[model samples]
Target chain A: MNAIEIKNLVKTYKGGVKALKGVDLCVAQGDFFALLGANGAGKTTLIGILTGLVNKTGGQVKIFGNDIDVDFEGAKKSIGVVPQEFNFHMFERVQDIVVNQAGYFGIDDSIAVRDSEGILKRVGLWEKRRAIARTLSGGMKRRLMIARGLIHHPRMLILDEPTAGVDVELRHGMWEYLRHINAQGTTILLTTHYLEEVEQMCRNCAIIKEGEIVLLDNVRHLLTRMPQDTYRVTLKERISLEKAQAFNAVKVDDHTLDIEIKKREELNEVILRLAQSGFVITDFHPKGNRLEKLFLEIVSK
Target chain B: MKREYYIALKTILRKETTRILRIWTQTLLPPLITQTLYFVIFGKFIGSQVRSINGIGYMAFIVPGLVMMAVISSAYGNVVASFYGAKFQRNIEEILVSPTPDWVVITGYVLGGIVRGVLVGVLVFAVSLCFAHPMVTHAWAVVLFTLLSSILFSLAALINGIFARNFDEVAFFQNFILTPLIYLGGVFYSIHSLPKVWQEISLYNPLVYMVNGFRYGFFGFSDVDPGVCLLILLGLTVVLTCINLFLFKKGIGLKN
Candidate 1:
């Protein structure tokens, strides 16, 4: 069974702004899925509809096979959402926020307390349990939100821009923690602008543009779809364009060359040609993340 | 009640009570001080001049009215500020995303207001005791009116909270609408003392019945029949609760 299935979902704001235009999506059980979109691409709107924060204009959403309209409580119980913005009360204590969130799921106070402590400790926030949420640093606050979202032990979790403003060091640890959680069998739907995170963590991905799904496939397949990768190599000696033509390499200048490695061609073959042609290669690396290049192409198109 | 519903209600109630208790200076102390000033200035100092009203000492005459006023304001203020504050801070989304039903959410908030309103009412009643020794002729009547009044005003406050967009909007309702209605509700004087037309107009004001019913409970002297007052309070409560439930189910002011 699918963890989540959204069918012909629609949302039109009060002022005639159609945030979503009949988007249909599905996530398999226990899959680490990425929902990629630019700002205003209706990603948040879709999340809002799923979580009951935004009323849908039309269509159906189901979580763990329960229709949201027919069995809202059942659907709600199956999924937890970590919103893009900090939505918990700022004046509330960290521990209280997590426990109170559990309470909404009808967890008993004693159980909520024990579970809150466990989740907070896992997020490295147990020591700051007594502090008001506003007093926590940005990274700690984000962790608190994650702890709150997980308190109910929902079958599925949705994270919207989970690492938008996090520092590199904190983001690294957060990514590891998220990967650990996903590995534990919680189906996660992540929406992040960071393509590198998608490349590293997501097994399946869907890119939405202007409220419609433009691309959907496995990460590996999407990477394979990119026809070629551009490599920048520093040469040991200057080579004429004519001399580099046999290898399909472009001469940037003295001691520099840009080579496009097609899908059917191997980088080793290029290196072998350079060696036999009496040209030495000093440095070689892809210009950037290959997935990022593909992402840019799709978004720009 | 379902166990889950019970837990959710208890959790929300605990949070709200803690909030009110945490800011005792703002929620409890201000009402105590304000009611004390009203007792000293209006009941003692001014009552000494007027001597008796409706065959009772003026101080005693105003006790039940003043108590009802406190109950009304505190109950309405608690829910309005708490709910609207939740909205302003976007913390209401916490519950909106949960499996808790909309009715439970409304009940939780209204129950919080009732608790605070009754607490403040009791405190104000204790303060009134120092000024006058007004006896409760029917204890159940007093309790019933107080409870119903709190429920009625709390429901109204929830409606106000739903419609309010900012702090200024909240203050606008409190200052322009709620306060005026209370003052004109015969809190300080008997509507019977007014000119015939004004007395008739006072009948149109809903606050008058609430205060009158509460006064009837204390002294058995009421401008309107206590039964009529009870009926109006119950009817308003039902209608307002329906409106609140509709708003929640329709996702007005709560969902985008």
Candidate 2:
């Protein structure tokens, strides 16, 4: 069974702002799914609806085959969410926050405390267990949030922009921790603007644009769907616009031009033409299809 | 459902109690200072000339009223501020998403407010002994009325907190509605001293029953029957609690 199923989910806020327009999604059990979108692309709204924070205007959401509205308690017991914003109690200690979350799930104090300490240690926050949430750094706080979410050992975890303000080193560390958790059979649904992280971590991907799912497929399959190939050519001398245009290339900068080649043989022809024009090609490389490029291509249309 | 509700309620109440105790400088000390000033100004200076009305000393006549006032204000203030602060920080989402029932959330916050209210009331009662020798004419009535009033106001505060849009809104309700009701509830004087028209109007104010019932506990005398006071308080609590539970279930102010 799928860990989460969202079908025709719609959310329209007050004042005629339609945040989500019938989004349909299904996350298979134990799959690492990346939900990608631009700012205000309904990523947060979708998360809110799935977690029962935002009221759905219409549609159905199911977790573990249980309808969210009909079996809310059952669905919620299997899911945990780490929100995009730092939404923890500032005055609460790290240990207290995690244990309290467990308590909310009906875990007794002894079990909750044991689980909380282990999760905190796994997140490298055990030493700061007694420190207030506000006193922790942004990265540490995010880790604390992750630990709090995992305190009850939920089957599925949803992370919304978990690395938004985190430093690069901490972001990498978080990815490792999340990957380890995912490896242990916990399904992860993540939303992030960081394309590189999604490309590296998620096996499946969904891109949302204007409250609709623009694309949803295996991560590798989506990358392979790009028809045009991008080549970054470093020129010894800046070329004229007309000269560059003659070879079907666009000048990216003073000494670099991006050429889109449809056929692999066309690359040789373009380089030869550039060489004949006395333009020295210092370096040339093909740019792999990145999520940013795919996003631009899909959304711009 | 029962298990999760019980655990959530216990956790929320514990957290709130810890918050009040942790911020003793703000929550506990301020009220103590305020009550001491009331004793100095109203009890010693003002009561020196005023005679006892109901066979109790002037200072003793107002002690229960003042204690109830403190309890009501603090009970309402504590929950309104704490719960609104949780909402403002967005941490309330953690509780909302849990398996705990909506009524459990409402009851948890209401219990937290009552704990703070009753604690402050007890402390103020202890401090009042320094000024006047007041006897508890009916121990069970005093305790019962105190607990009922605390629960009633705490539930009221929880509703206020849930509906409050921001910190200013939380303070606005307490300042505008709650404080005025406390003062106008005959906290300082008897309704008999007022004109017939004003006295009739005072009977409509709910806080008047709370104060009069509480005073009756301490002195065995009241402007209204003790039974009437208990009935009014119990009725108000049931009605307010139902409204709060309904609001929580509907996610009225929380969906935003």
By DockQ, the best candidate is 1
Give all candidate RMSDs, comma-separated: 2.0, 2.9
Off by over 4 Å in 1: A234-258, A273-283
> In lDDT terms, which candidate is top?
1
Provide the TM-score for each candidate, comma-separated. Answer: 0.96, 0.92
Instruction: Write out the backbone clash pairs for model 2.
Output: none
* lDDT (10s digit) by residue, model 1, range A115-187: 9888999999999999999999999999999999999998889999999999999899888988998899999
Overall lDDT per candidate, in order of appearance: 0.91, 0.88
Q: Looking at model 1 chain B, which ten-residue stretch has the lowest summed lDDT?
A: B45-54
How far is A224's C-alpha from truth in model 1 (Å)? 0.5
**Model 1: lDDT of residue A220:** 89
Query: In candidate 2, what are the lDDT values of residues B44-64, reduced to their tens digit?
Result: 999888988867788988899
Chain B TM-scores, listed for every candidate in order, come to: 0.98, 0.97
The fraction of correct interface contacts reproduced by each prediction comes to 0.90, 0.69
Alpha-carbon DockQ of candidate 1: 0.87
* lDDT score for candidate 2 against the true structure: 0.88
